[model samples]
Target chain A: MIVAEQKPIDEIKKMVAPYQKLLILGCGTCVKTCFAGGEDEVAVLASALRLSFKKDGKKIEIEEKTIERQCENEFIQEAASCVARNQAVLSLGCGAGVQDIARQFAKVPVLPGLNTTFIGVQERPGLFTEECVGCGNCELALYGGICPITRCSKKLLNGPCGGSQNGICEVDPSVECAWQLIIDRLKTLGQLDNIRAYIPPKDWRSSNSGGPRKLVREDHII
Target chain B: MKTSPSNLQKTLENGKFAVTAECGPPRGANVKVVRQKAELLKGVVDAVNVTDNQTAIVRMSSIAASAHLVQMGLEPVMQMVVRDRNRIALQSDILGAWSLGIKNILCLSGDHQTFGSQPDAMNVFDIDSMNLLRMVKNMRDNGKDMSGFELNEAPQMFIGAAANPFADPFEYRVIRLAKKIEAGADFIQTQCIYNMKRFKEWIRLSREEGLTEKVYILAGVTPLKSAGMAKFMNNRVAGMDVPEDVIKRMEGVPKEKAVAEGLKICLETIAELREIKGISGVHIMAIEWEEKVAEIVKAAGLQK
Candidate 1:
């Protein structure tokens, strides 16, 4: 899931302050699951913003609305009426969603209320750890399903650097060393030899290094 | 046997137990600091390793510092970390460093940025240490860059890599060393050794795998300044294992006597390291304490 956290209410307030009529847009999919931008969150944020603005003796109107997903045009249309009525949209969506809304409603200003962190899964409630970097090329099979490119602090492919101590990364004691996990998992799968093979220098051209990537699916286009 | 223009390599090749010391560049652009450190290390060690922003803290460029060492009639093993530079900058610096008469290069995946003064800095680990080693090897041996572009003159660097016998997944450490050797490392400098038992085990495994014959292995030794430093490293420093007995030994001494005890412990470790079959040399990392290096070397009877 796309994990993100809400920007501070102060920053959000400053962003929406110029507009008298504002819409607190919520994304119901990834951000919703992470509780950053959801129906309940949007309502709470709306109430908070109202109280904050009222305290300052400023008269501002806010409307809260959430759709199934902000990425797709169909779901985005659900909030079209609310978006048109407001001067600007305080998008409680990921960066991509904010851009998507901005692209659709070219005139309305779409401000990002949440900071899109990473493409990750919730390790536990309120705990989200990054698992993938979308490097475009995946070598999970060789690493026992562990992604060193994403998890390892150094993005080391050959093996763990000297920093891996007692299954913990030297970069952060809390973060488990990715190479340790790979070695253990490979040992469990009886594929320990996989690690012995030298992984050559990664081709960064496939990753974001090449530039913003695009995938075209002719079969799904029709 | 002279594969590169590295005096360190020649010394090791001539069946001599080489001695190398680390010299970190100053935090600011101060040539005097580097020269002062160089003066202390001059003639005491075979080659001085100029660290590239070690601990991820900003420092004077290693290349510039290494060039300074070259001017001072000292051989330098310019450490290159993959954390800061991409393939382009790394290759460019290799050529530039070699041009500046720097012969030896230590390839490393540098300390993470979070541990440094600039925690907010973005890191560029475009290549790992292994890849950096391979890249340098290719540039030196094949006379080709990473993109297969032929170079005007190959940077004939005596490639070096680091090893940590104390790091976890203990069994695979030897395998990693083998991989480093295969990747084109002519020599290996290990992380600081306080755990003799584990270091011996790692050496035994390396010997069994015959990795010792493939690459020169330099045992790393750092004189613990005090019991507090020992405890701090044991708990905080990554991949550093200071045994409880060693810490107790340091604590047993009075605060004023701790420095002498630390030197004694270092000398004892050097003696033990000398007896090890696969151990080729000792790389002393005095940290900010470069003055003690010559004294330690002379006291260990390594001063030629």
Candidate 2:
């Protein structure tokens, strides 16, 4: 899922300070799952902003609303009346969500309230770890499901790179060496020979290196 | 010798044990530092390796420093790391270095930026060390760029790569060495050796796999300045293993006598390295202590 963290309250306040009437929007998909932006978070932020503004002797009205997913127009249409009534939207969603909202309501200013970190998984109860880079070319099968491109510090194909010691990465002691994980997994799967074969230079054209990528589903288009 | 005009290549091809020392470029644009180090290493070693932004700290460009070495009548093994530049810059520097009369090149996946002065800098590991080796070899042998465009004139370089015998997944080290040889490394210079047992085991495996016959193996040796340095490397430095016994040996000496003790240990390691069958030569990395390299070479009886 796309992981995100909410912007500091002070920064969010500064961003919405110019508006007399503001709508605090929340995303109920990836950001909601990560607890960064959701219905509960929006209500808390709205109350905090109201109190913060009142203490400053300012007259500002704030409204709270959350959609199923801000990226889609169907959910965005549900909030049309609320958005039209407000002067600006403090979107507590991922970067994509803020942009999608901006595109849908062209005249309204949609400000991002959360920072989109990475496409990752919730490793534990609250800990999130990056698992994929969306490089467009998936070679996970060869590496026993561990993505070296995303995990390894050097992104080395033929690696470990003289930096792996005792299953730890030289880059940081806390991070597990990706090559160690690859080697151990391959060994368990009886596919240790997979790593022995030299992987040629990666064709990065499929990655972001080629530029901003666009995917079109011709078969699904109606 | 046919592959490159590198003096180191010629010496290795002639079946003579070669000697190479590392010369780290200064943090600032100081030509005098490079020249002073060059003078100390002039007749003591076959070729001097000019490090490229070693430890990820910004330094004088390795290509520029190597060109300076060429002007001083010293052969330089220009070190290029994958952490700084992409293919275009790497290829361009290769051509530029060769044009300046530099012959040898060492391909390395440099030290991570977090270890250097600039921890906030973004790295450009567009290609790994293996890719760099293959690319250099291709440009030299096939006379074509990575994109298959025929170059007007390709750089003929003696390609070298680094190895860490002490690193983990110990059984896989030899396999990686063989892969490096296949990827087009003419020579392999290992990380500093303190754990001789591990180094010997790695070499034995390499010998069994016939990797020794395919590429020249230069065992790396660095003289420990003090017991504190030994302890620091053992605990802090990643991928480097300094055994407790070695640390004890250094600590056993007085503080004032530690330098001499360090040199003695280094000389002893070189003597032991000479006895190893598959070992081709020694790469003395007297980091910031380049003057000791001359004394080491002379004391090891490797001085020409």
Candidate 3:
């Protein structure tokens, strides 16, 4: 899913002011399911911009496009046919989708209408919270089923920070302590002793910390 | 329709006894039904509300129909749902109504489409109704949107939000109503009420919990047309409670007298609410029974 967040409407309005013709692009993947940058959002944003401009007595043309998937280059072509005389493209997709579109047409400015939020899953209806960070390393086997990278403030590889009071994160009190979650999961799995074993320090260099990460597979290669 | 700005304030200061009415849009595009109902209460009602998909069922747009009410010399409170649109659409409709010079707006989270015509329709609840109210107030008061960003010029409108009187336990419902008032609601139009004693007790808690000074509380009175329909509301609609006594009253009345008896019950409820401290007005949700709205208001002896 293309994870995304929404920016302030005025900021977006200011960014698209000069361009009378614009495309409001929406992604139908992750952000769509999360109710962030979706087809309905694209229509609404387009309509809002139309109204905002009308309030100032300035009229503009807004074209809406909903691509099947925006994070991939293969799906980026869906927007190419619609980018005519449009000086600015308001991408309602996630960061990856925006980057893919921007890179394809380097001359035109691709502005994100959404703020990319996080890698996560929908726990229930009308709610979503971060649950994972793709560190190119699988460490859940060591820490139960919880991801320390995203949930834990320090990404503590070996232990919890001393500031975890009442089993809540010190960084943001709303966040559940990662170690606390790991301990709860272990208790559920009847393996609380797993926390007593020796755990190796996480090498930050091997994860997202060092640089932009990539992958290549021979079986998927054409 | 003729209440001057000063007169409205004087009424509020004198606290003029008021009666509000609800007129739901038809389940389809047929305007004849709603138009006929509007004609029935063209003069005797305070305001005719245009509900936007009351049960989340698709109908003629509320704004267009409310515009019709305004043309018919009735003040139309346009009901908007945050569950159907994002902050973007919510603001757009608000501005659209403002540009048309429509001032009174009723903000709602709306019935989730799961409870409406299409259960599988994708619901866009990126914003709640409270945030929607804040957005409208932002345009007028802070000259900003829901995100604390500036607007070109704010729309000055009287904003209203919903509260469920019979939804949760008495204390929880009162606390939530208090919270809604604190969020800058000019007035509150609540869910249906059958037991005025329970409603009176709920209003009593509002007094004990300090909710009166903030805003006006408009008690909702939905006049029942049939006992079967009353049972349908209590069973299917979440947060709606029609007491068994009201059901028995509905069953005891003959087909011809049921509607009149229902109107009497609503008038009595409104009169009872007026006795309680801090109860401001009555929002009559007569539904398809909009013809009886005038009768109820007249029977309750509310303001013209």
Candidate 4:
């Protein structure tokens, strides 16, 4: 899932300072799961902003609204009335969602309230770690499902780089070495030979290297 | 068979004990400092490495500094890090550096942005060092760009990469080296060597894999300026293993003569490194003290 963290209150306040009427649009999918831009978070943030404005003797109207997913045009259409009522929208979504909202509501100024971090999984409650870098070519099958691209600090295809101490990366002691995990997993599966194969350098064309990516489906075109 | 005008490559090819040095470009636009440092290393080393925003700190572009060095008649290894640039920018810079007569390129996965002045900065790690090596190799060998498009004229670059022997998963370090060689790395410059025992073991394992014949391995060495610096590197720097005895030796030295003692230690390490079978040369990274390079290289008897 796409993970993101809320911007600091001061920065968010400054961003919305110019607008008299603002809409805090929340994303229900990725940002919702990450607790950055969700229904509850938007309410909490709106209340805090209201309290802050009230303390400063300022008058402003702030509305909280969330859609199923901001990336899709259909979901973004649900917030049309709120977007029309407000001078600007403070999108609490991933980068893609923020852009999507901006594209859909051409005249309204869409501001990002969350910093999209990475595509990761929740290791446990309240703890999230990045897992995939979305490097067009996926080689997880060869490494026994452990991605060397996102897991290794160096993104070494033929790692673990010299910094894995006791299965922990030298960069961060808390972070487990991706290669060590791969080795262990491969060992368990009796697939140690898989690692021995020299994985050549990856082709970054499919990644963000070329430019912004676009997916097209001919069968679903209609 | 000749391609680049890199003296470092020539020295390594001739089976000679090559010596290279590193110089971090100034944080601001000060080409004079870079020129002075390049002049200092003129005849002292085989090539001078121009670091790309080393330690995540913003500095003058390595390519620009390397171009200046090329004009000064000094062969420079243009350090290109993956942290600050996407593939588009990286390829463009590589081509620009080549057009400027800069031949050597050292690909590195730069230090994370958090370590630098701009902690809030977004990093563009479009490709890692290994892939950078492959990209450069393809551009040089196949005369094509990342998209398999043909280039008007491909750059002839002597590609280099970095290795940290002191990093964790010690046993896997050699395997990584082999992979780098396979990825088209013509040479490698390692992280600073303070723990000789571990480095020797790494070299032994590398030799067993016959990787020594595939690529030139230059062991990195940095002279300790003071006991505090030694302690800082030992404790704070990730992947750095400053030996306890080396720290103790630096501590044993008097305050006024600590640098001298450190230089002596560096000389001894370089001498010992020359004896290691797989070790081809020494890469002296006299950070911020480029003036001491000539003296250290001369004292180490690496001046050819």
Candidate 5:
């Protein structure tokens, strides 16, 4: 799931100030679940902007269309036909939705209505926390099921840093030590001795921190 | 023609047995959905109230829907919720609705963000529902805004609010209603009522406590169509209490008979509400069940 947060109303208002015919698109997927760009928020924001535009003696046609999902091309098309007349689309979806809409519309400017935060799950109803990062490689088997790239304070692969104390990382004591989890999982499987094996240093050259990343599968692409 | 304030006052004074119905706007831009509901209930009910985003789902604007209702020759009561809007937007919408000659209004704070498909939403209860009531009254009476600042023309509206019983303590609910009444609420449309015994008792108590004379009260009713609907009302809706006997009746009957039973129960409740001395009206909430409303009213022995 893509975690997202609502941009403050003022910030979004400024973002779409130049557009007269505004089309507020609501996504029913991630942004809706996160309460950022859902059906309700889109209506509220539209009403607010409508009144604001009215007070300025400006007649702006701010329409609302809530698609079931904004990430997919098919669902985004549900909003496309009606949006051509509008000057800009104020997307109440995730960052992916804004980009996807922009890709589809091409001519019309698509502004984000929510700040994409993370990819996470519903820990419980009404609450969501950071979960997966979707890093290019998966090393979960070597360190239990818990992802070190997303959860660890230090993305240690070879060994646990010497600074760990009480199963907490030294960088932030509140964060659990990823190495400790790996150790526990290993002990459970009677493979604690694997820690003695020398592992190569992680190459950061291919990671997102260097620059943009792309994936291409020969089987899927012609 | 614009009716004089005194004429409105006199009409409202003798407005006993007033019947109201609700129409929710469509989620899409097409006005047909709302217009269809308004036209179906028009002339049959005294006033038609348009709801703003019930259940926090996206919909067309209630004000625009009210405009359509007004065009259809129905007295439109525009519902405004402050939960989404700041004071500026709320005040402007009220004035705009009034300028459009749509006078009656229902001021609601609306559903919280947590209840909707959306969570983590920012609730600007900057001004609660009561304060909006005071603001509207102050704007018209004192010719000033909420901050005592002057405006060129203040909108005069027939103010109304909602009351929920059977959720919290009944006395507290009554007290809350009394507070809204004290804050210049001219009328009240209550939450859904399925049991007349509890409703009549509440009305009797309110009359005893001097609530009946101060403001008009309209009991809200919505028919429970199926056993699933009854279950949803009982569990999902916080204040609405659909009685087990009614559910049992619906369950035991055939599918066709069950709808008739539901309509019959609603008519009985409405007839009972009409007989209550202090009750002024009934607000029928036949949401998607608009077609069954006329039948229900006729069965209730009310003039349409």
Candidate 6:
């Protein structure tokens, strides 16, 4: 799922400063699971902002709302009334969700409250690490399910760039060397020869290099 | 079949022990220092390597510096790394370097950006060193650009890549070198050698695989300035191996004569490397001590 983290409270406060009435809009799907822009997060931010404004002797009206999902038009329509009453919205959603809400509600100024990080998997209960870069071309089969493009700091297709030490990357000791992981996994799978096969330079057009990508299923289209 | 001949290429092809040196362009547009460094190595060395934003520190472009070296009648081995430019910039620069009469290029995946002054800067490793070598080779062999467009005139360049014998998973280093050679690397310049025992092991592995016969391998050697510098490189520099004995040799010396002792160590290493069967030559990297390069090269009997 997409993972994101909330911006600093000071930055969020500044973004909401000009508006007399603000809506803290949250998404209930991916962002919710990541704890960035969820219903509970929205309430906490709303209460914090109310107290901050109160101490400053400002009478700013704060409203909170959480939609099932911010990316879908059907779910976005559910927040129309709350959005109509607010002067601006502090979108507690991923970048896609914020952009979607802004696209639907053209008049209201939508400010992003969360910094959308990456497409990641939860490594532990509270730790999420990026697992995919959505390069549009998947080559996980070659690397024993390890995504070198995303996990490797250098994005080296033919790597472990002389800095892999005891499975730790030279860039950071905390980060595991992606190539080391791939070699280890491959050894376990009896495909160690895969490392010997020279993977040529990747054709990057499938990724973001070609610009914004979209998909259409003609058969399923209404 | 060679369209153009580079002195270093000719030297290696002739089976002579080649000698190359590095010249760092000034952080600002001070071409005087660049010229001085090149001048110091003028006839003593076969070619001078102009580093490209080495250590991610913003410096004058290696291309421009190499151009200046060309004007000085010196062979400039322009070093291009993947840290700064995407494929477009890289290909464009290769053509530009060729137009300026630069015949050699060393492809490397440069140091990470965090070590530089601009730590927050975004790095664009659009291609790694291996791919860069292949792309350059493609341009030369196919007479076409990376985009598959035909070129009216393609650059004939002597390609080079980097290797580190001291880095971890030590057995795999030779395989990586083989991969780079297969990817069209014409020459290989290793990282600075301090742990000769470990480096010998790597060289032996390369010999067993017959990699040395395929590509010219120039061992990288840096004359240490002081014991402090030796410790810093061992502890702080990634993938560098500075054995305790080498550090002790420097630390054992008095502070006043440490630099001279350092040069002696480099000379001994060169003498030893020449005796190795697969070793082709030496690339002396006297960082910040470019003035000492001529003395070391002459002492090593490379000044012909």
What TM-score, computed on C-alpha atoms, does each candidate reach?
Answer: 0.98, 0.98, 0.57, 0.81, 0.57, 0.96
lDDT of 6 by residue, B4-115 (tens): 6899899999999999999999999988988888878888889999999998899999999999999999999999999889999999999999999999999998888987
Off by over 4 Å in 6: B1-3
Best by DockQ: 1
Per-residue C-alpha lDDT of model 4 across residues A1-222, encoded as one tens digit per residue: 999999999999999999999999999999899899999999999999999988988888999999999999989999999999999999999999999999999999999999999999899999999999898888888999999888887676766654566677766778898988998888789887787756655777788766988889999998
**What is the DockQ ranking, best to worst?**
1, 2, 6, 4, 3, 5
| lDDT by residue for model 5 (B1-304), tens | 2344522233458774777888888889998887788778876777878888776677888888888887877787788886677777888888788777777888776765555656566655446566677778887778787657887877878888887655434433555677678766898888888766667777878888899989888899998788778878875664567788877877988887777777877887887787787778888998777877777767666655
Which pairs of residues clash in candidate 6, taking residues 3 or more apart in a chain or in different chains?
none
Model 5: lDDT of residue B153 = 77
Model 3 misses residue B140 by how many Å?
A: 1.1
For each prediction in turn, the share of the native Cα contacts (below 8 Å between chains A and B) that it retains comes to: 0.74, 0.72, 0.00, 0.46, 0.00, 0.48
Ten-residue region with minimum lDDT total, candidate 6 chain A: A192-201
lDDT of 2: 0.92
What is the TM-score of model 4 when looking only at chain B? 0.97
lDDT of residue A219 for candidate 1: 93
* Segments of candidate 1 deviating more than 4 angstroms: B1-4
Model 2 scores a TM of 0.98
lDDT of 5 by residue, A140-199 (tens): 766667666566543434344323444665445466666666666776887755644434
DockQ of every model listed? 0.82, 0.81, 0.02, 0.39, 0.01, 0.63
Q: Which clashing pairs does model 5 show?
A: none
| Global Cα lDDT for candidate 3 | 0.73
User: In model 4, where do residues sit more than 4 Å from their true spots?
Assistant: A2-118, A133-137, A151-180, A187-222, B1-5, B142-154
> Could you list the CA RMSD of all candidates, in the order they appear?
1.5, 1.4, 18.2, 4.2, 22.7, 1.7
Q: Which ten residues in a row have the lowest lDDT in candidate 6 chain B?
A: B1-10
Would you give me the overall lDDT of model 5? 0.75
Candidate 2, A27: how far from true, in Å? 0.9
Under the 3 Å rule for N, CA and C atoms, how many clashes does model 5 have?
A: 0
TM-score of each model's B chain? 0.98, 0.98, 0.90, 0.97, 0.94, 0.98
Candidate 4, residues B196-282, lDDT tens digits: the string is 998988888898899998999999999999999999998877678898999999999899999999999999999899888878899
Flag regions of model 2 displaced more than 4 Å: B1-4
